[model samples]
Target: MTEHLTIVDHPLVQHKLTHMREKTTSTAGFRRLLREISNLLAYEVTRELPVTTREIETPMNTMQAPVLDGKKLVLVSILRAGNGLLDGVLELIPSARVGFVGLYRDEETLQPVQYYFKVPQELEDRLVIAVDPMLATGNSSVAAIDLLKKAGATNIRFMCLLAAPEGVARMKEAHPDVPIVTASLDERLNEDGYIVPGLGDAGDRMFGTK
Candidate 1:
């Protein structure tokens, strides 16, 4: 966990995160907050993106300006809930290629089973960011990353709105190289494997469903 987890605790992030956690938050409010928070998280997660210098002329002068270097980025959203975070991150990095992975729990084994997978071409050459709203059991998160790696994604990162200790540990053990960015890491998961004190099912909250 030490090597892989990167908790983003900036003041703006924390402030908005608190709002999203409130029980009284409306669907519209929750969605808006998630978008804002995701943008804040993206800023921190992409801090080290490679930059190259290019000649540019301003109104008064010509000078070398910094631009994103090399390949365009890819954003792989773990379907359903992950789409919430994806909306905000996309707002910030509109040029990034989009991908989707859908995993649902098998009732018998309670393990994640992938139902859909799609990613950008040349994933090996681009920086990839996998977004999800919650890291509860970690099964889906780990499985999603495994799929991404198999598709040739090398430089990868995970972003979530909230996470539990168990999930973080599991992810670190499975993929030590990929760093995780999240707004809050809660105390633990409950008996049913949901993050304690979490704001309920993110997909439900975002979609105004029970």
Candidate 2:
């Protein structure tokens, strides 16, 4: 399976992303922009969700209304940073089942180590979307997806605010079938495993951490 990656270069997405990259952006402002971008990204991500018809009574007459098909969708957040995107997505997809995978990177090795994992049942039948803000090294993203697949999720998509080429290539090599969606694909990962020209650590900027 070929790995399909989507670049969401919508003008607004790019504009807000620019502000997000600036060092002077306040936490509140950064968060506000992320929420807006995530909502818009959610639109592109769910564009192809299967739909079914349900008969409903309108003000004047009865008509068949298009509704989402099958089981409610699942949104899996990859730990602390993922929560930022998760909150915005939940605002739009309120009915989506939420899950979390806690994976912290070993700074020296740039490898992912799992600490916690929890997800909704019947994942096999749901459209599982894993969310994380920055895909730097891809180890955490790949590890998170591996857990999802083990738990019976067959259809999975990954969404991120920004991605480095290293992370994208890593994900492609590991999971060729899972598609990726992101606002920007940055140049490369620095030796310290951070995206070049990235907005620092997403978890740090978002939560005011060091």
Candidate 3:
């Protein structure tokens, strides 16, 4: 995931995202779809993870089997909506450590304000993947990464369900070294800083909040 941005356009990912975007979709349905899509996105995000082989004995033979190398990766959810994706990725990588970064947008300023932050130790020794449902303004994402870096994380990647061009540019400019992986790169953001043609406020829809 060295590229600045990676869009996963797999047919299944696109199909599930469509259903999630539908206004008529129920809360449970939206959540289920998000979890499924998260799995697909995780596959693309971890595509370049390091691997090593170890000799093992099979039923009737001995061979070297490839397995993930180094320390267990860290999954840092961006709080609230990020939990939706976190649940799915956890199922895929149960051994990975989990953490959270709590941030909210200041409507007037359209900036991010952090409220809470907690992550695993030895971040510099393991890969760090930050998960968030939407990358609308990118303020929160960039701010979160800033905190992660200050805490000793050298390798970090960002994962989101939907991203706006504005947010993508904001991230690239703020943190050129961190790569972004998303399901769709949607149209520009709206006046309120919402991703146009996006699946709406991910936190609201997933939680059935107004």
Candidate 4:
């Protein structure tokens, strides 16, 4: 439950996610809750980022102070719903560089097709975190990672609100080095590839897309 992937079970995260999954939660409420929970999830995902120290003068005296290492991190959103989570995370890591990978599933094929892709420069040098609210089938998530790799990203992490078992296995098989941090790992995906007991379509619920 906590090795290659982490299920964030903090009380705040759980409470917000519970509200988020309710069908009766309004669009504005859903969006607000998503952002709040994202901050909590981002806190856990970035916990092990490498850090360095520099000497600086404090109010009392000069001392070496800890700081995040290297250039600003790169946050790559997986489009549409990803943007909702992205906004919340940015409030926490405001200086991070941002990027987006837009993909939509082919209803017939159930495969991902990328439409837009742009990343910050020097991706390989900066830590990269990809955000998507739902990881149901994992096709789009995996494809997004593939594009990031081609763009020279090496160190990467994935964060989502909920994940299906199938999606987790797919991610583990495709990108074992990239860790996944999610609010919950739900049961199986339904016949149509939706996570069982999922919060409906994340993009629809969050944006009133319908």
> Which candidate number maximizes lDDT?
3
* Ranking of predictions according to TM-score: 3, 4, 2, 1
lDDT per residue (tens digit) for residues 13-48 in model 4: 999999988899999999999999999999998998
Assess candidate 1 and give its TM-score to the true structure. Answer: 0.96
- Pairs of residues clashing in candidate 2: none
Q: Which model scores highest in TM-score?
A: 3
Q: Which residue runs of candidate 1 sit more than 4 Å off their true CA positions?
A: 1-3
Model 3 RMSD in angstroms = 0.7
lDDT of 2 at 157: 93
Worst 10 residues of 4 by lDDT: 1-10
Compare candidates 1 and 4 on lDDT and give the better one.
Answer: 4
The Cα local distance difference test for each model comes to 0.91, 0.93, 0.95, 0.93
lDDT, candidate 3, 14-116, per-residue tens: 9999999998999999999999999999998899999999999999999999999999999999988999999999989999999999999999999998999
Clashes of each: 0, 0, 0, 0
> Relative to the unseen true structure, what is the C-alpha lDDT of residue 20 in candidate 3, on a scale of 0 to 100?
93
Each prediction's TM-score versus the true structure: 0.96, 0.97, 0.98, 0.97
lDDT, candidate 1, at 41: 95
lDDT value for candidate 3?
0.95
Candidate 3's error at 3, in angstroms?
Answer: 1.2
Model 2 alpha-carbon drift over 4 Å, by segment: 1-3
Q: Let me know the TM-score candidate 4 reaches against the reference structure.
A: 0.97
